[model samples]
Target: MRTLAVTTMDPRHRVLCRIRIEGAEEAEKICLLMGSEVAPRRQFIAAGATELDEARIDI
Candidate 1:
């Protein structure tokens, strides 16, 4: 498991830092806990997806 600090994005962007999930299984558990909420879990997932997209482009 690894955690990363993420800040300094556009101010309009939501900031979710130090959210540590080990793998897909752990992420699933988190999703289950979150349970259909839209504000935060969606935001976090969107942020992660955005980061992954950016990383793919960089590579």
Candidate 2:
């Protein structure tokens, strides 16, 4: 089950990066691949049909 997630800042919640992943479990790996530190204050959002359209990540 592939999904899309966006890592964001802590207080501002500004989107730092976006990625298309394999599953919910891949969220952490994606963060690391993007160079997140020991405990990066970020966020992850899975993509549904609508979200895919919005984010425009090629499947």
Candidate 3:
């Protein structure tokens, strides 16, 4: 198993989600999965969809 640190930043909302994963190559995979799931939700609440696309994540 490998440990990965995932960090996400939503500039529009000024929110951040940092997660640590324990698995084999799960860090990068989980980061994208979580971003895909949350980006849309954030877009719905944001001024526009593009806001979420601008979101940044460091893995």
Clashes of each: 0, 0, 0
Candidate 1, superposed: residue stretches over 4 Å from native = 1-29, 32-34, 53-59
Clashing pairs in 2: none
The global C-alpha lDDT for each of the candidates, from Candidate 1 onward, is 0.55, 0.47, 0.49
Winner by TM-score: 1
Clashing pairs in 1: none
Error of 1 at 45 (Å): 1.6
Candidate 1 TM-score versus the reference:
0.26
Estimated TM-score for each candidate: 0.26, 0.19, 0.19
In model 2, the Cα lDDT at residue 41 comes to 33
Instruction: Give the alpha carbon lDDT tens digit for every residue of 15-43 in model 2.
Output: 55454555556676554646745443343
Question: Which residue pairs clash within candidate 3?
Answer: none
Tens digit per residue, CA lDDT, model 1, 1-59: 32232333445444564545556666665665357666777766776774575644522
